[model samples]
Target chain A: MSKLYESQKLALWYFSVALVLFGAQLLFGLLAAYQYLNPDFLYGVLDFSINRMLHINAMIVWLIMGFMGGVYWFLPIETGREVVGIKLAKLAFFVLVAAVAVVVLVYLLVQTGKGDFFTLWFITEGREYIEAPRWADWGIVAVMLVFYFNVVATVIKSKKLTGILGVLIIDLLALAGLYLAGMYFTPNISVDQFWWWWVVHLWVEATWEVLVGVLMAWALMTVLGTPRKIVEAWLYLEVFLVFGTGILGLGHHYFWIGTPEYWLGIGGFFSALEPIPLVAMVVHAIYDAGSHKLRAANKPALFWIMAQAFGNFVGAGMWGFMHTLPQINLYSHGTQITPAHGHLAFFGAYVTANLVLMYIAIQRVRAPEGPALDSRAWKLAYVGFVITIFGMVGALTVAGFAQIFVERAVGGATWSAYIAGQEHPWVREPMYWRFGFGVLFLLSYLILIYDMLTIGKRAATATEVKPA
Target chain B: MIQGVEVLYLIGAGLVFIAGAGLYALLYAYGKIKGSILLQRSSYLFALAMLGGVAYIVAHPAFDTFWKSLLTVCGLTYLFIPKSMLWVMERVHLREEEERKKEKHNPFYTNY
Candidate 1:
């Protein structure tokens, strides 16, 4: 497990890119948070719309890079072959990096253009998360296709299709194919939204989750030296629960989007069940920790995976269930509750998943022929994790609940309700707390980066390596 | 009356109930695993205490029949979800074993 294939070096490149983008995402996120408290903070210099777009887009780019990096790193490990088209894969990497840089420059420098097809094609499509403009979208698709082709060829060459790689290919295909769902425009707003949710909801809820499943299974095996049968068993069970609940869980989003009345029942019912899988995953982690006598060969990597489990449970499962029921969504829709759920879910599920891979990758690449490195930064990062997950998320949740009551529950979406919700003491006060925690998160990111910058290069004495 | 934490508490009750139930499932499934008996037993104790908290949350002045019923269903479903997961795991393991046997290789480690 400590030894990495030489081809795994390509993954480090992707992770390094991801690290920069993740930092940018955080900066933009903090900017958006500040704008919430003070709209005039950036004023015309950097509009909230622009800042928020960068925040979200940067997040998507960085997290996807994490996925690609993890896949590249592990594919060789699983299949016993280096990635096919390695030179092309690296070329695709540059194309993607350049495309991201161009898109951001265009977003900031050229901000907006006419709403005609030209703007849609070149400048901005004005969609929420996938706002990379149409041309860039095509470029992204091409890059992903290269990544996909490399993975497929390697799997074929390996002549061995383990459960993890098998599911991984299917997920990669779905991942690439689903991005197309958000590319085109529709005449009807509902139809447009329907397709939009295909990209947004399905990616996070479906493909990304399956991707996490594969990665998590591999990670547990690598870190815990758990038997393949047990991990694969959990993988299959997770797939069962995720597809059973998450697909229809999109019904919650469908409820108000001009969908059928049946969605109310379906969405409410399925979304409630959504938390079941997350809880189940958390339980499985407990089982592993208990059965293994509470030790992981790679503690930092396992810590993030455990964080993914609990964080996703509290954030996506519990927080989502707190409001996703049609009855509750009635009052919490479009409130800060949405962000409250989103921040935790994204941080818990995907961000932690990436961190798990990064920690593992860093560990492998940093000290290949040596004992396990000390988890100096992880100890510090743990504090940041709590501050962000608890302090920041708690602030937003309270703000959301406050807004839900003032705006949706009592005021019922009236004009006055919007204003009252905005002015509510609960809502306004929590923003300051959110900003405070965000600063702490920044400090935490610096500590993590410090670790990233100088892990394993030191001459310090090595920690005792546990037998995996 | 209805603006603040009353609703938040209801959500907390349902989640707490689920956590307690999930802990029970973990204890039952992995209670024999080494060194966690006290941890699991204390967790079981907390699970029992959580029930009392759920009761208080439900009995709050917001206690309407619909809310109470919803809470009940949430509690019961979670109370059994871990059991259901265990059953599903057993079934999955059996299927995996069958697939591996038929293919004469571990399905997870080799193509089946």
Candidate 2:
């Protein structure tokens, strides 16, 4: 009964890997943005295809790791059972890491065109199934199965299912669909674009959104002492709003992909509905906090969960919905506005959830004494969330909205056209303001890393009475 | 577009929507009465109808455009599902009933 949930440790391992990927993503993002201003910034060092792949791939991996960790940390508590198998959980983690490494290797090899990997998928002389050197894709599938087995075994043994299970099962099924869809895609750019969004855009906005929403509800209940009944009720309501509006939200991605005009309505209407769950989450979180007078056992974790709920609404829901109108998405899809969705949705729905879970993980492992937490550390993390998320959102939105005019209306007529059309106006900002905001975000990451590492005390603390 | 094959597409879509709406209405009524059994039955039936509608849209050549197929599919799904979405609505148990007694005795929370 007292066995430690090995799943949490495995999740943490993935979290570390995710952070490394994030660092790489950040570097690529900076370079990608800079290329607009200076197309030849790193001509030989970074290939566009490779860097874009890494940026998008890393972002996806990081979000997945974060969600996995959050689920691992919180599921047991929600279900009132210790994790079933420790060894299988650890095995799954190693498999995933190996899979990720294989992917990076394959991506690099294909970029160089130095091997048989390039023509394997669509052309002849492709790698044979087990012998094809396409180990990465196989590795990923294997990893998924391993994880599915472990999670399923645990759920069956526990004999108790949380709302988390409902959302999780759907995501798992969606993952299978996405993978299959990816394989079946042809080489046509427009068709590729359509299929690509089915996997990438739909996964994040629709499937993952449901999982994140349900998990947040569970987290709110755990940290804020909200009754399970209320949280469960909210989850039920959220499912209707999420699926009713979410499944077709993928149509938002279909606008510029040579798809038909009718999708505009499907995408537009559903994208508008995308905000419903986000707003519901905010309402649920607030109601929980107010009901308990903002009393939280782990205040920092609670803060992040709430922050995630808020940012998700504003960034993904509000900003995104505004651009979902056919006319707007038509102009906004490839512009800076896409980044506005990327920045907020990534941080708000995924990163924020992980941050809260990380705090909780630190607490459980450290076994803090009494009600006293490391206040400085908590403040540092909260501040980190603020600076990074706020800067990214603010800058990206301005850049996005500004690009609309240059790209669509003016069509790059002159010097202003060349500059604005070519890139976001990051260079146009006052030097001091840009420097200040940029430095603030860098410092925020540094502070966050420091805070998380230093959460544990030096010596064993005296035991405190457990709460009932 | 309203020729023989096109008219067949329209008819198929119409039937899917009508069946879906009927099932959804039944679920909504059952939900209002707080009858979990009837609600669950309606939900399953409605989901089947929705899936069938999506299939119809996908197979029909006249509705091959991404936008139209997506709209009709989504419309059919929403139309078939009850507005309250009782399938997903958690029952707010105000007090214990004979059937509720089973869940109340579930050892997970009490044993902990």
Best by TM-score: 1
What TM-score goes with each of the models?
0.88, 0.73
Candidates' RMSD to native:
4.8, 11.2
Give candidate 1's chain B TM-score.
Answer: 0.62
Writing each residue's lDDT as its tens digit, candidate 2 over A19-128 gives 77766666666556555445686676676656666666777777777777776666666566656665766777777777666666666555555334455532222221
| Weakest 10 consecutive residues of candidate 1 chain A by summed lDDT | A459-468
TM-score of 2: 0.73
| Candidate 1: segments with Cα more than 4 A from true spot | A1-6, A459-468, B1-74, B84-112
Estimate every model's Cα lDDT from 0 to 1: 0.77, 0.59
Candidate maximizing DockQ = 1
